[model samples]
Target: MMTFAVYLIVFSSVGFGSMNINSHYFNKHMEKLLVSRTFGLAGIRNIEDFWIFAEGPMLDSLFPEPGEMDGNIIVGGPRLRQAKVQNNSCEVHSHLKYLQDSCYGHYTISTEDREAFGPGTTSPWVFSHTGSDYYRGLVATYGGGGYHLELPSNKIDALQAIQALRQNNWLTRGTRAVFVDVVVYSVNVDQLLIAKLLVEFPPTGDALPSWFFEVSRTSLFSKSKDYYIFVCAMISMTFNVYFLLLEACRLVYLKLTYFSRFWNYFDLSVSIGSIISLRFGIKNYLFIASTLDKLPDGVDIPSFEILARNGFNVKVTTSIALSLCWLKIFYFLRVGSSTLAKIRVSVWSCVLNSLGFFMVFVLLVFAFTHLAHHVLGPHLHEYSTLGATTTSLLRALLWDFDLEELQRSRPVFGPMILLVYLSLVLTVLWSIPLAIFARSHTDVMSEISRRCNLWDQWKEMVWGQYSYRQGKVTSEEELRLLLEQEGLTDEDMAAVLSRMGVRRGQHVDSHHLRNALGCLQDAEMLPEVAVRWLTDLKQRVDAAGQKMVALTDKVHMTLEVASGDGS
Candidate 1:
């Protein structure tokens, strides 16, 4: 018994400690990861015409370490160079603009490719950029993920151009491999950082306030899709704690009855598995693109595409985790906490309030598609466009949206009406506390009454047994103690027993009048009434034994006759 008690204590301690560690670890990892995960791919005017901005993960390695961030605005100047058909081949006339001004970041390409614009003169220098473009992905705006193989043998360029103009504008004309360029500012909002911010630039040519991104600590974790998987794993564990720890586990503790603990173990196993799976996912990605002497060519496509796919998987898992959260809220509504009842009862009210958020997502899609339909004659475009607006819509849901706009577009009834309705609906929340208080009060009162009734019967039994180890108890006190132990209080028990004709000095056979108590061990898989009846029979064996005797009509006469015959 001592060993079992010790084991239970140890189990609880370890479980809680593990939960803390996992939560802290996941939080810190997510915080750092969020900073590194954002990379922006923007169209830069005329320096190879485009730039890619990678914020967090993309820069963890590529981004130069601290102090390396200098006070220079322009990092490097890359311009195209013209070369003849000779194989001295490629060179970018890169001038080191190495002073970091307000902020700093490192910029480098795998190998810069600068080519001569025309065969005659090196005067027209042309610079070109390429990046993790090897793996095949569709320019979806042109159509789903199909790459038109540009081979000299099949020269139908005109038809291809026409086909592209007929679909989504997610791409551009003559796009070669995509190049990723990054600019990382020491974005901390300290003295030096904000001083850099005072540089006056006008979006409306000095007509408006400049838009700036402030480094506020909204969450320690990144809003990146990459972190979604781990977030989901943590959410799953939270659900397990709610259902397994708070509810089912408590039920087992109550009534002191033993049953299966399979659900507890199952939830723990899933938590562990999710942690392992994420680690393995990260490893498989970077290691797959290995460069060796035996290998003839470099890896196909950039690594980010695969990383993006992993992010999508995490999103799916996150959705599952959110669903679990709602499930737990519902579970607690039923059996454990009293507060969740009203909220659970009127979730449709909460859902009604959320229609605005839902509409935000839906309307954006409709607006974008309607514009697309207008331009390309119903979802067509010019210049094999790939990513214009639809992708932006999906991204907006995950990354916050502009709430100010939502505020302006108040529905016809006004936001107040809906707000009031939501509050009114949530009024059901009153039920939870009501139920809990009622249950607790009722249980206490009933226990007191029961113990009081049993008080007298218990004293009689104790008195009968008292002579054997006797102590003075006027029948009343002994009966009171027994009734109290059965959950009846002194006053209530006195009143009830008085009504039952059990007075202070009464002495009667308790066995004849005692109502069988229900067994705590819920054994049978049948109706509770049936099980209670069976338990009563098991306890009254002595009464059953007396029942074997029978009264005969001529029993005494028969005995007299028998006596005479013997004489």
Candidate 2:
């Protein structure tokens, strides 16, 4: 338990530090982007909308005019790139189909292509900036590719760069999506903040598709000289390794029986997961930091999308492992406390017994889901698909349904259908599991009580036999001598004897003395040291009694020899 506490402390410290640094960077960049007018680029479906956003307001208010900014502003501030499908011949039946089909073949334009186009070039891929000229060039070559547009620090150069991309067939049917990466470096803290904006084109949408934006941050000196983090890492690794070995030894000792216990699985999983989470978390942090440091100049800046994804993976894995670690605390508590142990048994039994009832409940929900989907799918958006219908029905079971909306969709049937679902699921299906758990809990409590009574009876019987044997070996004199040696005065002995229900001068055995000592201890009349002295004195008195008997027998034999010699 001490080891577990130390490990958790170290792990939490490292996790908190990393989270603080990353969240600071993320929020700083996200706040700026959220307040920017150009952040609504996700709604850009046409060239007119794109131009309105690009030229209307600056990307970041802090650096409204890139040319006016101090040298502190990083050179790799903001850039744009687009991904296009290479093979446009695939027959896309729906929006989902288009997404999946496009995934099979898409490519972003390389850094070399952008560099070759040179500054002020109208078209990067072709001689002319026209759509026909670009199409002709694509057909002559590999048929399709993406474009990289570099927006220099100066406002004029940046606007010119935007014009170059806008003149081409960039937002055509072949285009999959456009990405805008904005990187800002804070000289005060030496931290790099990044924001990635993704704008995807839908196959069949009159309104523009909603855009996605992700923000992340990393520190420059974090990886280099944080000795505290290094120490935490070493300590965490050591504990994880120790736990893994301990679990492995237990598995070997228990063999297949080890899997029968649920907490054993938790033990093994948390150990392995902690190790992997830590390893990858550190590796990804360093990798992202290094990538940010080596970012190329011009339009050739590398995508931070993959690096951002790696960081997200680290967060998710670490969260799961840490949650499991905390949950394992309950396992230890359950083992140490009888009340918790009984609760665990009752809950587990209830789950096993309610499996059949759960199956029926699921079937009922499934049937209602299909019924709602078929009936209201055409008119109501909520029940448009099977998945959506299931969600709506489940929500309705929890009284989250809108009766007005349902009635508006289908005035007569909608309310009736919901009433039936709620009545059956809430009144019938849910009640069975509750009853099962209640019954299991009662049975567990009764069984524990019966076991407790039986245990008490067994203890009483064993102690009775022990007292009988002790009475045969010890007597009143021996008890009195031992009590005196234990520092009991004559008055104390008389009072103790009175408490034991012994009359004046009555015989008292070792069993009676034992009972007296127990009463004194319970009443706080006897200290632990006195009890130990009494125990030692009792043993010494018994040994002395045996020696006296042997000596009396020898004297009697000597007296018989002397009598025979006189005769």
lDDT (0-100) at residue 61 of candidate 1?
26
Alpha-carbon deviation at 200 in model 2, angstroms: 3.0
Across 115-223, the per-residue lDDT of candidate 1 in tens digits comes to 3332223222233322322222222111111222111111143224323323332122212222222212233211000000011111111111111111111122333
Relative to the true structure, candidate 2 reaches a TM of 0.65
Q: Give the per-residue lDDT of model 2 (tens digit) for 371-463.
A: 999888888868977877898998887778889988999998999889888888887666888889899999888876655454444335334
Instruction: Mark the 10 consecutive residues where model 1 has the least summed lDDT.
Output: 190-199
Model 1 residue 73 lDDT? Answer: 20
Alpha-carbon runs more than 4 Å astray in model 1: 1-304, 307-407, 430-567
Each model's TM-score, in the order given? 0.30, 0.65
**Candidate 1: deviation at residue 369, Å?**
23
lDDT of 1 at 526: 23
| Candidate 2 ranges with C-alpha deviation above 4 Å | 21-51, 54-63, 66-79, 83-148, 167-169, 174-176, 187-189, 207-217, 220-225, 296-303, 368-430, 463-470, 473-567
lDDT scores in order: 0.33, 0.62
